[model samples]
Target: MIKYALKCEVDHGFEAWFSSSDGFDEQAAKGLVECPMCGSAKVTKAIMAPMVRTSKEEAAPIEMRQAVAEALHKIRKHVEDTHTYVGGAFASEARDMHQGLTPERPIYGEATTEEVKALVEEGVPVAPLPVMADKPAPAVQKKLN
Candidate 1:
């Protein structure tokens, strides 16, 4: 089945599905097709936006993938070199820092969903990292022989 964005002479736009391009022409020729909004038979195909393909490698070049990997690696390394690992004490550590009970430092760790919610509710300014805070760089899997 094929879908086409259609526009009528009255400037109304809608979508219609047909078996094929020929099927649409055959239906339109016999006055079987009409605009849903205006009931006008003077409908024609509108310029449709191109569909995006989502399959991984089909969407980007190898070079682009390599570049992205490099960028992510750099970011992970920077985070590792700079931040203190608070482990499972993330919520408490963040709270202590926020209340000036501890000196301010960049820290990463695990927190339960409820703890994260509490942090946000208290305006503790926490953000979840894209990579797992514990694993970081090695989160990118290496293919084994």
Candidate 2:
């Protein structure tokens, strides 16, 4: 079976499964396929990106992994030391900044999958900061240099 991303003339995008690529072509040609949203038979395959696994997914050497982990830890530590923690309200806070409802500043917090997806879809600039679940962020020095 194969899954295809399809879009209608009205730009309603959807996905459908078929036994083979030829099956989709045949059904579409026969006007058997219709858009689920607008019920439009004038549908075509949408520009879709296929999932691909690369050779780099293989586990690296222990030293390499450790180095990468350390780098991630440093980045998280910098954010913790320099940025504000908004806890679970990250998505709303980010949106506010994007819409100019709130002053923009560096912030770190937890966000739900749906919230993050919505933020990205709406074109709000946000990125995930790596954190070590089993470890703690580095301590900020209190004594001035």
Candidate 3:
């Protein structure tokens, strides 16, 4: 199946599907297609770029994935090196900081789901770490090693 962007003489734009390229020409010649909004039969195909699909390997090249992994690793490293690791005291520490009970400082730590929900409800800003895997990717590990 093929889809084409069509425009009428009155400049009304719409789309229609055809079985094949020849089918579109045949239907258009017989005035089977008409502008949906203006009801004009003088419709023609508008300039369009064809959509192409590449194989999975080509779609996400190794270099692209490696660059993304490297970026995430840098972010995780920065957070770990710069932010205080409060461990299980995440909820209390975050709450204290928000309520001005403690000095404001960047922190990264573990929090229970209940603790997280409560923090959000109380308008304390907190978010989960984005590190997906406990172990770094083989590429990153190799670079470190």
Candidate 4:
């Protein structure tokens, strides 16, 4: 398998794995390759410096992955705590902000794949939030009198 750093037309960076270089080309040509964040199919391979591995131990350690995960969690928490939840109107709100119809503000919400693609096409900056698994609600206890 080969790993590639990919970017969407909107400049969202991501990574994917393919069976081969040819496989990547084929998938991209067929519109099978898409950005994980915004679901934009206008994805392309990003410039990558070739890594020449000297030893198996040169791979990233578990600690590094943990650190990355912790950082992402913190970012999610910060956005949730600070940004306005615009719900399903994320696309329109972002567009309004971009067009100066609304005040620019930190906002987060749900948006469809088409909405994101359109926003990107119109030069509106928008991105998808990483969805974490929902925590179960607290259980209700019954009181016997």
Candidate 5:
């Protein structure tokens, strides 16, 4: 199976799946393919953009690279927009906030295995994110080991 980015003559863009390239050609030749929105048969393949790589190394295909990059970008943006970092004082701060001793806010921080267990046992809502907590501070330059 294959998917093609299709565009109608009216400039509407959409996706279409076919068994093969020949299937797409057959459908187009018979006017079986039409724009879902405008019902126009004047459709053609849309140009796909190549993916951007982070390193000089040759990697997976462009589409897979683009998908992974997009997913990472979305997660990073979500963390930036929705969460606050509490640094190393995560467990105690979380407890304080949960117990009403401190103001509650969306926070991410470092906590030991035992500390996390305690928080869960006490019913203080917490979840781990896919991102690493030891990210370098803005002022510090990171050296890849």
Candidate 6:
């Protein structure tokens, strides 16, 4: 399937889908296509960049990809080196700190989505950490090896 941006003589712009390039031409030539706003049959293809999508590997060559990977690794290393890992007690620890029951300090830990949401809803500042390539998958909260 192909999609095209179309414009009428009156300059009404819209989008429509076609089975193929020939289908658009056939429909336009027969005056089957008309502007929904102005009802003009004099519609033509409007100038538009083709929609293209590529995976990370295709979008960035090896050198560019290596640079990105190195940057992410450095970020992970910084967070690991500077932040205290609190295991599964993250939500309670954060709440205690916010309520002045505990001293505030840099920390990284695990918390479920619900816990994180509740913390945010109650105005506690929190952000998710980036995924590291060494990890199988990201946890609900931050943790480092």
- By lDDT, the best candidate is 3
Candidate 1 backbone collisions, by pair: none
After superposition, candidate 1 runs with Cα above 4 Å error: 1-58, 132-145
Better of 1 and 2 by lDDT: 2
Q: Which is superior by TM-score, 2 or 4? A: 4
The per-prediction tally of clashing pairs is 0, 0, 0, 0, 0, 0
TM-score, per-candidate, Cα-based = 0.49, 0.51, 0.55, 0.59, 0.42, 0.51
lDDT of 1 at 41: 71
- Candidate 1 contains a number of clashing pairs equal to 0
| Of 1 and 5, the candidate ranking higher by TM-score | 1
Error of 3 at 83 (Å): 1.3
Q: Across residues 17-36, which tens digit of lDDT does each residue of candidate 3 receive? A: 67888888998899777665
On residues 24-111, what C-alpha lDDT tens digit does candidate 1 reach at each position? 8999999767665434577899999956666653534546645555566666667777999889999999999998999999998877
Error of 5 at 51 (Å): 31
Question: Candidate 4 on 1-145: residue-level lDDT in tens?
Answer: 6789999887889887678879889988997787877777889999998757786646566466555555555567779999999899999999999999989999999777789878978999776665443431122111100
lDDT at position 116, candidate 5: 68
lDDT by residue (31-109, candidate 5, tens digit) is: 7777655456778999977446578856456566445445545565577679898878988999999999988988887
Question: Residue 13 in candidate 2 has what lDDT?
Answer: 91
